[model samples]
Target: MSLLFNSYPLARSALFSLDAETAHELTLSSLQKAYDCRLTRGLMASRPEKPCRLMGLSFRNPIGLAAGLDKNGAHIDALGNLGFGFVEVGTVTPKPQPGNPKPRMFRLPRAEALINRLGFNNKGLDAFIANVRKSEWRNHGGILGLNIGKNAATPIERAVDDYLIGLEGVYPHADYVTVNISSPNTQNLRALQGQEELTGLLAPLQEKRKALADLHGRHVPMVVKIAPDLDIEQIDIIAALLPRYGVDGVIATNTTLSRESVRGLPHAGETGGLSGPPVHALSLRVIERLRGQLGIAFPIIGVGGVVSGKQAQEKTAAGANAIQLYTGLIYRGPALIGECVRALG
Candidate 1:
């Protein structure tokens, strides 16, 4: 192991001392600098060879970094070197969004969680694609997934327009495109998960995907990232619709609105989606329910609250074809990726 890998605890201490979003920006900036000088590769721990194929694409390992961590994909190469098999970027919208407001992201250290209402903040699809083109991670055979969402200003009824614009824009560049309708930060965003609303969203997107596939001469997969706060009936509805719309896969969860696990903890009352250890069980339950309904052949990417290798193992055991991390990476650093990969392998 390199010194940086072993010294992450100390580094995290310095980072945690800053404001949550400030710390986020500083970390990515430093990481991007380290990557530019080729310092990240040697600083990383050994990555185990644990290959898996999904969504008609081959992954170098089953451990992937979830979307939120590198929203605009400005640091894909830097993050990919940390030993992830795949790196997903964005919840990028059709247009620029300022997101909710300051103090929108709060740390729940006692609960090993964070609550954020960032509301898909980004420089918009055009800048997002520009950043994506600048990345060289694909030269190393790294898998990249582009996650898309509607702008916060866009009304709920016309949300499909934004998603279609996103899908079409990112289709040719992405290894897979993720339609993210599950984020709790955006007002009325999760309503798209409802039965009639979901049908209205997926039907048109699939039609666009088919046309795009023919236009580009390649069928880029479409995966839906869902929320953890769901009942069995909702899971069934989503599972049934996925096949009906030719959806390629499902990401078992986004964040949660529930604070049942961290009720008394500081920042517990904050109004945003919670993510970390508290969400592990809820995410697992959803994964299990999704597995049961979607069947064994369906692709399910498990995420949320995997703060340990044991949890990563549990995700796969509970029927996840693969696993991802975000909050866990915040607490444990880059080493968490290799640890999860070794456990899964």
Candidate 2:
């Protein structure tokens, strides 16, 4: 094991002592420095290649670092070194905005969960694209997924405009672009998931994507990230529409507003989406239903509550073509990446 992995337990202890968002910012900043100095290279555990194809792109492995960890795409090289098959960044908007007030993020250690209402706080498209262009990983063949969203001030009805701007801005840089209409933090963002609203949103986006493909001479697959709070009926509706709209893939879950699992835990009543072990079964159920509805060929990226190798395998067994991690990284460190990769293999 590398020294960084060996020291994480101690590091986690110290990080856990601080507030959640503070610790998160500190960690990302440190990682940015480590990556810039090349200190993070070769620190991850070695794993044999287990390449897989998804959404017309080849992934080095099926395990990916989920979005929201590096909203600006600033830590791509550093995070890429952590053994993730791919690294997804941003929930960026067309313009920068300060998200919800402080203390918006809460940690539920007992449930191995986190509740966050930090509405798509990011440096916006220009800064985000600049960061992506500066990343060394871009030239080195890292599978990068850029997640885009509407600004908080944008009305729900006009949300498609923001998404179009975001798509145009990051289309050339991303291996795949995730349309993040599922984050609970943004007011009424989930409204876009409705049958009429979803179609209205996806149809034009698909047309624009075709134009972008023609302009760039490369087709970048567009995936939709959905919430885990939906029922089987809703999942089936989404599955049916995806292929109709020419969507390349679907990320089965973002986070959930349901608080059934952590009802009595600290911060359980916080108004935001809950992620981690509490959302695991819900995510699996969505993936299972999506697979059944979309058939075996359509791609599904499963996320929520994957903190161990066992959970990672369970996601694949439940019908995930690929898996992503976020809350798990908060609790397990980078070692979890290799654990999931080896388990998936």
Candidate 3:
């Protein structure tokens, strides 16, 4: 468990002084203005290109911004300025809904972790797509991945309908799409990861993907994002199912539900997925298990708690084809992006 908090200590101190979610909003708003003023590039580290090809798309570097940080695609061009080769935004739902109650996000500074129950709080698909279209990131050769999920009020049984809508809506705009099935904040959402539910979701999802591919004249890949809390048996089941159902890749894994590593730390008992350094080992284990079960050629984007360049290397070593950073970005700032990219290189 390394400290990304080490890189931008003073800035992190200031951001940490506020409530976590407020700091998040303030940071994104600040980034937008900074990018507009053409000052973001000046603050970023040297982003030497480290080209990688995966899921039939080219990435300028393997280090990407993970989904939750830009839940509506509003910060794409600005975050792209942070030296990430790619940026994935939104756990967007078909309709907009206010998420979990206030104070749903908590910080564990000593543990270098965060607990969030921010369910998929995003503007509806229409606004999300409009924001995506407004970005110049893709024109500059940055890869974009659109992450989708069901609305909180959507019944667990009819979840596939929401995902299908999300799939169809995002296909034309995304370089790739991520179907997020593992966020713990949404009630009973993890049930979608079960064998019966997964097949039900994937079959129709891929079927729609084929249809969308024909209409768009481009075969955009569909990636599944799974949780890090899975057991070996669940991993085995997922490995067998992914290729059979035509999933282009799997992001192993999402923020964890376990707080065993930070039991005594502040906010340790908060209700939400815990992300940051404490999750690094869990994420690595999931990646290794997936790689072992899925074989060498199957793509895995390892993410959970990455706080340093060497930790980034550890993910690749554990069988991640690419690595994503979010919680680390919170603690370390943009410098962490270049650090991970160079280490992966």
**What TM-score does candidate 3 get on C-alpha atoms?**
0.96
Question: What TM-score goes with each of the models?
Answer: 0.98, 0.98, 0.96
List, residue by residue over 175-246, the lDDT tens digit for candidate 1: 999999999999999999999999999999999999999999999999999999999899999999999999
Query: Which has the higher lDDT value, candidate number 2 or candidate number 3?
Result: 2
Model 2 over residues 1-345: C-alpha lDDT tens digits?
Answer: 578876888999999999999999999888767766754555543343689888888888899989999999988888887777888999999999999998899999999899999999998899999999988765665699999999999999999999999999999999999999899999999989889999999999999999999999999999999999998788888999999999999997999999998998889999988999999999999999999999999999999999999999999999999999999999998888888988987
Cα deviation of 115, candidate 2, in Å:
0.6
User: Which pairs of residues clash in candidate 2, taking residues 3 or more apart in a chain or in different chains?
Assistant: none
List the lowest-lDDT window of 10 residues for candidate 1. 38-47
- Per-prediction backbone clash count: 0, 0, 0
TM-score result, candidate 2: 0.98
In terms of lDDT, model 1 sits at: 0.92
Query: What are the root-mean-square deviations of the candidates from the true structure over C-alphas?
Result: 1.0, 1.2, 2.6
